[model samples]
Target chain A: MGWFKRIKDGIQTTTKDKKETPEGLWHKCPTCKQMLTTEEHAENLWVCDKCEKHHRIGSVEYFHILFDNGRFKELETSLKSGDPLKFKDTKTYVVRLKQAKDKSKLTDAIRVGHGKMNDQDIIICCMDFNFIGGSMGSVVGEKISRAIDASLKKKIPLMIISKSGGARMMEAAFSLMQMAKTSAKLSLLAKAKIPYISLLTDPTTGGVTASFAMLGDVNLAEPGALIGFAGPRIVKETIGVDLPEGFQTSEFVLEHGFLDKIVKRKDLKNTISNLIKLFAN
Target chain B: MATLIEIEKPLQKLLDQLDKAEHIQNESDVDVSKTIKDLKKKLREKRKEIFENLTAWERVMVSRHPDRPYTLAYINAITGGDFIELHGDRTVKDDKAMVGGLGSIDGQSVMFIGQQKGINTKMRQYRNFGMANPEGYRKALRLMKLAEKFNIPVISLIDTPGAFPGVEAEERGQGEAIARNLMEMAQLSVPIICIIIGEGASGGALGIGIGDKVLMLENSWYSVISPENCSAILWRTWEYKEQAAESLKLTGEDMLKNKLIDGIIKEPIGGAHNDPEETFRTVKEEILKQLKKLKAIEPDKLIEKRIKKFCAMGVTK
Candidate 1:
């Protein structure tokens, strides 16, 4: 009843005509309850203008935002696990893979690109939380590992955007191995003296946090992103204490020195470009 | 209860008989002498056999035995009283869960860092049951960086249930801290040797675990998940932990066979706790030998080989 009342209040305040509102024309801000036309959402880069909420963007969108003139060559992940564990839960692993593949129209959680940031060459490996919860199995792991290899070979800065719920449990042990694999290759990146700036979006947790996402030379998180290892419910059950308010948020993590900076989504490209230039010089 | 292992029940029974016989008889009591002697011989044989045939779960039990010597004890034994402990991650208060400092093996200066468990109730609470927070790992990284600065070799003793899973740990970046260590250690420009002196559960052990040579003590295990946790997740109950240990292939011998680890350091016949002196000697010898070989390697070559070594691990079929 309370939720219904709130919804009614929101509709009453909106000036837009209900009948004329086109399905694809308007998108409501999940945080502040402001309805914006599709044009307005794109103009704001999907950021909620009223609440400053950073909406989730896919890897393709990220490539456009960071790469020069929205032009870049996409590097194929070409990695499919072959459903390695034959992992099945309520649905067979094959069925889940097929459904996710059909929905996301992507091979795996990650998308790799060799592109330019402010006309400077760089490598980008961006993850999508929509794909299998952005779980890092062998495919995602190998793709990122290969991206690191490409960066090493090219001797360029690397930036990885993370959005995930951690390792895919369906993939089981095969998923766990990726943590080590990514971390080992990341060190090779470090040894090559290449700068890596990790950009963490909402809900970066579990094995990814334990590996490359946290291994960046300069760790940056978007505002209000949920970045941590164990999620809240598990932590609450284990520690038997009320967690600190705003804990695991980007701002909170920054205060504790876990993150180097909290970069708003709007400033990410310019900031990364500046960093690459600074380091290069 | 002395916590006799289930598989040792037969041996325990014989020992109990000897205890009873010794108390009820004088030296001239001839009726039970032959029986007691035979029982003693049988107990000895049974103990030897059990030690030889211990399953992975039983070894897990031994690794966590109450009387087992902890990280500090081994450090003291290895350093021969020449050790100094450094403190703090410099950003937060010193996490006693991770203890490290400058120490030595056979008078050669080496840096030592390890997860420390409590010897008693008060200490255990203070140690957080050897589960580290983010500061613990950052503190370890700081010390590791210090070791690298001096170009000194590092010896990391791993013993943790896992990284602390508290909300605070997550909020402060426990996973990131561990991940950063794995990446940084690979390029430290100094020899890094890791030994699983106790439980090596997932990311916690691996925080400081990536090394040129990773070793494990006999009766210790290194796995992606602890047996109990693995059992709970896979079998949906902790009751199948013993079976989980078997299936996980977590023992040091298993690790050696899989090429995840370089070698398995032998504990005393029973365990490290049964004869600490012998344990200390064997551990020291193993460290010295590994250090000798590691020290001979060029820094760049060492860093290269170290990365390749870990990259080769868990290339699952």
Candidate 2:
């Protein structure tokens, strides 16, 4: 009767009466198109339970997964990128940095943490693709350099979880020099006989791959991760030909004898711990 | 004659006029020697002015000028027919894009390595447009290690658009090859000098670019990405390449200002293509000077200094 009678024609509700579902409440698997709650997704370490596809995760997730009791001490948490080149392309580099910081809530593309992994002291520098595509700028370089020093000083193993789109273009030559800077530091790590594990995740390409990402004493990658010097699109455009399926994937790289092993996301901590133990002996 | 860029067009016109005047004075009985001399003086001034104030994009154009001198040209001129060419990475077939061998600069034996672009279209295709594949970088590493074995200082001339971007290049592990070079070159016990002779784009250039003294030739451009590529990425179009070049600050002066490079070697007015011999001479002198400075340090000290030098790069707050 109330519905039939238009007593309150155009029945109004106050703004406070409106209710809507918040974002990030549900997750959709890109590979399987399966729907699951966010909690379930997080419980699975962000990997798709239905398809076993490893969705790209940031440093926060990686640290929680690898660190002991999800506890760690962050290094250079305030180190930020300087506008060395004062670059501007549709937007000023400073503005872009601010925007990236605001959107990602990160200081830079990389975060270095000191913690015990499987009861073994380790220094891990993880890159976040959410921050400017995880492009290695001056700040990333400096942080990694410092991390290497930390590893050398503490006599602990070092690990880098690389998920990047290569060198930051806005920094220009400064970005290019980071490659040399980080590699030089890694050479010191090698000289120190410290175990340096490089973990390549999804979409690691460009200068990062050509520098520290590949200089690992033991190079490991996630399943189906994209790892290469050049992006597939650039390669395709340069060759003017169609790329075969699964090109530049972790499997392809492993087949090419570039990678040491392909470890699943769930087994990353144990596998890395085992590797550190092997290096220890 | 070498091809001229947009900024060099006026200089080219002036040069043509001077040529006509000289030809007329030589062929005929006219006494136009004064005119020829005046034209020559004017041409020199214009060239200096044009090159001295070149915009970043103009330098990029000059760096990529088809007639610009390539690595082999400099090696040949510097070594003066004393270069012994080496080939192959031992594990893979030889890559012509990369050329490395033993050479002497005024009887000082050195390992000369560089990326060599082709002189013509056919040769360009053969050289892969100066883009090295993984094997090319591997070959460079093999040569560097060989140089270290012989206690020879390594002089690497970097000039490349970037590493090869083909599927086979990726399959062959281009990134690892370059990465290995950076790590190995960092501690090679021998003095390493890297000179950016031209287009030093991203990791391709840095593949062999780590050194105690990293220098750049005037008119050469070095950056994380090529101007066109950067423009394409940031501006979503290549039309803003000039703007991108300015923003990138990729010229030799910019690199020196940023302390990314040790110094800038002056090129002949217009560019290296204008007077290749003079450019070669200046490069040889600079190399010799830097080599002398670097050679005085012991290997251990040299390695430490090199690492420190690179570690000091990058501005962070």
Candidate 3:
């Protein structure tokens, strides 16, 4: 059978077998059309085993994968966003926010909390790129600020894994204010003698990369992640020049020494745990 | 595609010879110190005649010189011995742009925090051009609180156009970080000394700018917002940044005159990049002098001083 047909058959079979509905599935090996099941794909962290092409995972799944036995206490989740500008640049700000909330099933773009990676207590704040491209708004700012506060209170360190598009335009000036707000929180952490490390994942860009994502005590990156303030395309357009090949990807960034380490997804848990243990002493 | 190639034998031979000429060019053709001294003499003569009416753009360029002494350089220059870096906000990732650690300056144990700008392309990317995010500021706060715990003095190096304004930064709470730092820093008991080493733009710089004694390097610039952003807002033209710079009064001289900075550390002729050693020595002396003055002040007085200093910023006539 042709590879495409086989993949189609696999998806059809999975859909037919599962009585419960799947949120949404877009699984395909670009190079080789191999039928892959979500169950089979889940094990590889959404990388196609046949072609090795990676897929984006939601923040909830990401936390589950990184933590031991899905053990994590979500902190500062109750914080809601305020419309600081009563902003009106595009469609109504409230409407866009409500849409983003519904689409991502999240109150804000990031999830911040404390969790154990191999039983090592650490703070984990993951940006949900799926949420309005993970544009940071007031709630995200408040949550991050609180996360740092929690870390300081607990005297533990933080690990932030970021995958984002940049600042949320709907929030306008209030969104811009977050840069200072977050930096101030970090200053407090510095004062408190706590450690905060950043894990730059795929497509970390804009205001996010400009701020906390780039401000890691020991910055790490996933293989092939894109890390920069502007996307290569946008920068090229703005600068009126072609970007060098492999300009902003994690490997290129690592080569340029933007990342302290280029860690593989499979090994990320162990690596972070080891670092946490080293610091704990 | 392969058939059109032609080899330039003569050119290839010359290129090969040129490649072997120098790997590491260490020896100077002229005596560097002597040449610098002569240059300084010329600068001094020129300064007396006419301190050239500097354009706002020139100040901006001066603020961004690659060779400018950054926070890390100052820390290394002022503090002797091995330094240990502390990490993590205990809730998120460690921030590289804002580096804080336990170290000794002139044999006295202290906690240090600085916004570090990397020298080369690699380091700049690593340090994010000293533009910290929420986490970097949080890390600085962590260090400050730690200093209070240990009763050690705190020194912060301020540089950066502003905090990172990216989606992730906002998502993670950039504004809250800066606000909390401003609020909490005012109450911290440790004697804090802040030195504006380079660009000190906007809230990113201010996040760690709350200090008992705030100093500015002669060539450094600090402002509420960067000239470029201001221009974009005021003129709807980023290119008009030069005009915005002039209006902002961002230079150390301007800031000192306005009482934004407590004092200015003299830089060598031209700029710090022109003579790093001289710049280093002068900064060291000034910082030591300031620290000594501050060491005598009680903790309550120190906090009060910091509060008063910030409250008084941008109070225009």
Candidate 4:
């Protein structure tokens, strides 16, 4: 009877007077279902403390992780995609671009910047998966090409962090041409003897993977990243069979002799600097 | 899998009517020659009209027509059966999806490479429907490097649904193979010409597509993704493929206008399937013309221009 009775008249705080935990305060580990404070999760470089899963992050987080003091000079911020095909689907491509821009606060899928990683000068081009699934369009291609040119002119090492779905379907052949365009520019970079490092993150597939993402002199990848020519779904659909465990992961790719190394997020800057120094020697 | 394109269906009916009229005349004492002649003229006008204003989707259909000449057909016709089929990447099995060889085109030794779709159901299965695996692309690159060694002009005919989307393809590094080809092709010291004779989808086409000059057949489509795939992605269904095709602007003319291609090789009326011989002849002439022009340049300059041409692609602010 005492247990059933209200315990000393439950606290009289009204709903209006009570406070709620703000949204985004906590982060959930997708792999292990562990919850932790967002700050703690971010401090671990977005890797799950329990399961070590690397959560997909954007250019902002990458810049923070790699750039010295998170300070760098962003390049070609003014460039945006044109509706060359005047493409339309359920919605016009122009509208989709606008919506993606507003949501991601990015002009396009990629951001190029030059900064010192461990005090070593390097040009980094990072893809934001939030922006149209990091699809390579004209803007992405032009930006990467310019980044390569900068690396050549300045004689600095170039690094690209690929996190993409594929080429932008809306841009059509213009998107397809980006593979050739960026690869050709990398050829120029290769001729100049500038060290080129490609970092493949989660979900690098399709045209992006088949071009500059795989053209690096040294191809590095994050652990457990999905790195392949075709998406797992497409591959499964095409092959009509269940894939093996760890298929197309960075580990699998490394084992298959496609990747040079797998570096942890915390060691990325140091690993890159050391590789650049080695190339310099 | 409809043999006749929607726009060409009326023309097919007209031709059928003409055939009936001719049969009547050939039979006992029935004079239907005048009707046959009038029907022939009408068929000509109908064909012209159908081809002239073909929707982009119809062009896609034409590009995939089963009767269209595959890569080997063009190579054999151009070389007068003088093609010596090259086999194997030397590192892996010879991929049937990609066919390459040394051939003589008008007394000039040339290296020919292309994605070879099958001519029949069985062959299509054998060829994997023209979808090249990593080994296929590697074989292509090997042939191109061989052409570079011998100072022969390299001609690549592109026709593929895409690079093969299989687990083994990824395991073998499809992307790296294509990427290496692009980089190596950009600097290869031989005249490389790429012609999209059929489907040119994504990295598969570009794997062997980099060249001093890139041309596309009139009905063929070259795009980042096929219209059906694009529609599936954007509209969440394949039913909107026609709209997707129109939106993609992936036809040869669109490519020319976009400066993604050097020129569009006009197809025979209806499509390349309607007159494979004429298609082969036109492609041969275009390839020879482009090769002559490209060969005039020094190797170093050719490489430089090739890089420059691709570098100049992609419209950005």
Candidate 5:
């Protein structure tokens, strides 16, 4: 309810009645409830405008936000999931899966489509956390794997926007196995000689951290994403100790030699396109 | 009273055994060599225990044993036909640590990419003790590309002590190379089966560890970081490696329990190298079985399933 309230508040505060500007003039932090100025938000990568909290952007939205208008063509979009295990937890797993499917409004947690960030052909897989907490389930895994295959086939670079709460729990062992499955797939992508860039958003944890999210060609994180495997609560519980200030956040990860760079959301497209152009195939 | 007696049956048996162990019998004053022999027999019986009973440090040792068999050894054992070793990344010199070649596994055309460690000093230097440099990872990437082009199922054997940490490796970009492998491997349309024959240590093992079916030798281990490294971090001393190992959960048993690996491949008694032929046969059978299962899935489903598998790792209770 609080999250929905925040979204509603953001929608209510926006004064543009004619049309939403391309890439917009100003925005609010997706996490903390704060108003942001256009210039300040631009400087911070359209992040929070005030609180510097990173927000989820869809593959198409990411393309638009990063590149010029209507530049991306979706690739490997048809991969879907049929319940393999017939798994059940709490209620029938399939029932919950359907609910997540309806709520997320996406076939899977990830969307893999190719587009130009800046006149450069790059395959993008954007993990939407709003979709079942952006858990990597079978369909999400397959889509990402297919995206990599497409990138290799086309001989282009890949840019993944990661915002996950790790692997999907309802899927049981079937879900946990994705860590190895995706990692293996990524290994093949490497063999094909393609560069994979990871753009870590908020709360990339669990199996996602164990596999591809951590294994980026150029590991970049948003300003405030928590990028560790064991969340702060779990880690504190496990070790019987309090975490340092900002333990799993992107800034902490960057400081600990885990991340490559911390790119503001505004500069994401320019930075990625420049990198792609620089490493032109 | 009868119910109480029935409940105490198991406890009485345990108490009797403990009493026998604690008490001095008439044989205690007998021949010293005989006494020594009895104690040795007891110790031998203790060593025979498996899986759950093992201490964390013992698991680490088991994971790192030279005679535990490695990726190269398994590949050699599994492939009955002729093999041709591939070399070079085309962008750099060949890395001996990682061996990839054209091979046939039970008549199925395949590309083999695996980390090879050494049992001795000369071999360790030659194989970098299974610690791959950037070039090693590069070679793997090249091989995978070739395999994808040919639509060959890539059989990757993972056994490494993490990526090479030398200055030269860093200069060439060790992290970047590992990351590159992770990125590229995800997109490969062709099937991959990664088997951890020995130590699956961190990023080094992960460079070639993505797979449709990821299997581990029963005694092998997989983790994000080694016990020593974890110990250095948590306790500030390598001596706390045992403690670190327990905390890190790096054992094959733990991995299988945690669902980090698909299943465990049974090994020969006294480890793989003790009975290399038997170890080879078991590995081959298991691999072939897994390959057959994976081959049935459609390419789209395969990729999707693989992605889901990764996405869902460590998400369970």
Candidate 6:
């Protein structure tokens, strides 16, 4: 059987059984409601071919897409969150961290890797939203700050893919401190004139929007990314007003000159490499 | 927001008695003028006492008082009506929430940038309640850069609960805008001073907050997070915002103790709202004094020392 047909059959069987199987062989696009075979979905770089909707992706997929031949040395970004507050609302923070680690197979939301893109050395940190909404805590902060150091030491270009809800509520003030700490570290890269490209993805909000994610030398975003300091619901509650159509979408921000460009998933690598070459002098 | 002259529950009964006594005096048939004079004196003294002993949460409420003087009031006072309001981010339309301009203080040209909370409901709507969009930060940065080009000091008056958390603000890169300001302000050749005139909550305040010396009003609160929001995450109810306020150590005294701010500016006995003119004069004098010391240093040393100063923050004293 062809890979597409086989995967589609697996999805059909899972639905027929209705047992909630671990294997998800076919997926539906949230935008256009188009069912796509999982094989075709991965091959399309996780974007919906029918609707061209950029699907939310994790750091690992991004590494494959951006790194030349999907090859790179992943940075050791495993810093403990330290559960500074011993905070618990519904569940203990440590328990939540363990659950997140189990589900995402990531030590934390961010993954840093040093690799070649179009024969140019670069450091890239991608944030994964699947891990507790990619809420930045001490681990996320320290890892990304170290990534900045890595770029400065190696004298390579840097890129950060942002996907977060905001500061991790569990971490409280510790998470908020990251805003200042990360911004302070980014200035070292700025003083060195090292090029840093910021690529924002779905649901970038809160403290992340106010820090290193926004400090890129060249700021870029994936098409239709929800990038803002506050989400729409919280804003409506705070301001008691309905937002204009397309208020915080990539196109909306680009029109207002907040971003340099909105690059397609397919074009992200080439676009970044071209910019890197421009700054190669 | 405040309902002008609205007192907290603790002082509400006293104010009500004062009001009744005044009304009796105004009724010519009553002839209670002596009682009215005593009530007025009691009200004044009571206001001073209550303000002096306010809880941190009450202070938070006062900081956002609708009738309180905002950044524009202080800037206009300092400039002595010579404030020429500038506009636009060049790339985006001007943000009404963050206002900046070329203004003169005692004949010395300086760039004054600040968050503006409008006075009335209509004006508040127009200013987005002093919460800035990303464009606002960019506008502030553009004006500061202009000031830098002309060799002028930059002063930022911070008074935002936080940056606008609207989806549009995030979409437009609010974090990037604020982060850029922090980085650029550190390297700015000209002296920079920041005054937290009201609420200095989280990254919103920090967006334009980096400076050689950071100051706060006696009642102003500066924290990593706002009390209500902190309460929501911690205790699951904003009812605990008072507790959160106390725990966060956000008052002016906490800021001074933590070394987060250079000093605290004294407000009127009943807060800036009771006497804005006196508050403005004091702020103006404080600015002029800080400017005198700041201007004496060379540009490079000013930048270097400014960076070092921020780097030393958060150290345990």
- Who wins the TM-score comparison? 2
Best by lDDT: 2
The CA root-mean-square deviation of candidate 4, after full C-alpha superposition on the true structure, stands at 2.8
Worst 10 residues of 3 chain B by lDDT: B1-10
Q: Which ten residues in a row have the lowest lDDT in candidate 4 chain B?
A: B1-10
What CAPRI class is candidate 5?
incorrect
The better-scoring model by DockQ among 1 and 3 is 1
User: What is the C-alpha lDDT profile of model 6 across B99-218, one tens digit per residue?
Assistant: 999999999999999899988889998999888988999999999999999999999999988888775675567767888887888788899999999999888888898888889999
- The docking category that best describes candidate 2 is medium
| Candidate 4 docking quality: incorrect, acceptable, medium or high | medium
Question: Model 4 over residues B1-317: C-alpha lDDT tens digits?
Answer: 33675667787778778877888898859787889889978877888888889888988988888888999999999999999999999987989999999999899999999999998899999999999999999999899989889899999999999999998898899999999999889989999989998999888999999988898988899988888988888999999999989888888888889999998888877678877899989988988888788888999999988888888888776
lDDT of 1 by residue, A211-249 (tens): 988888889999999888877766887978887789788
**Candidates' TM-scores?**
0.83, 0.95, 0.50, 0.94, 0.54, 0.79
Candidate 5: chain B TM-score equals: 0.82
Better of 1 and 2 by DockQ: 2
lDDT at B248 for candidate 1? 65
lDDT of each: 0.83, 0.92, 0.71, 0.91, 0.70, 0.83
lDDT, model 1, position A37: 90
DockQ of each: 0.36, 0.76, 0.02, 0.80, 0.09, 0.25
Query: What residue pairs are clashing in model 6?
Result: A206-A229, A209-B175, A210-B175, A214-B176, A227-B170, A227-B171, A228-B170, A228-B171, A229-B170, A230-B165
Model 6 lDDT tens row, A1-281: 66554433335555467776357889899999998889899999999999899999998899999999999998965466676445565577789989999988888888899999988999999999999899887778777777988899989999999999888776655566567667777887888999999998997877887787777888899999887767777777865888878877888778877789999999999999999998885
Off by over 4 Å in 4: A1-19, B1-3, B17-39
Clashing pairs in 4: none
Q: What is the DockQ of candidate 6?
A: 0.25
Provide the TM-score of chain A alone for each candidate, in the order shown: 0.91, 0.92, 0.86, 0.94, 0.82, 0.91
The alpha-carbon deviation from the true structure for residue B161 of candidate 5, after best TM-score superposition, in angstroms, is 0.7
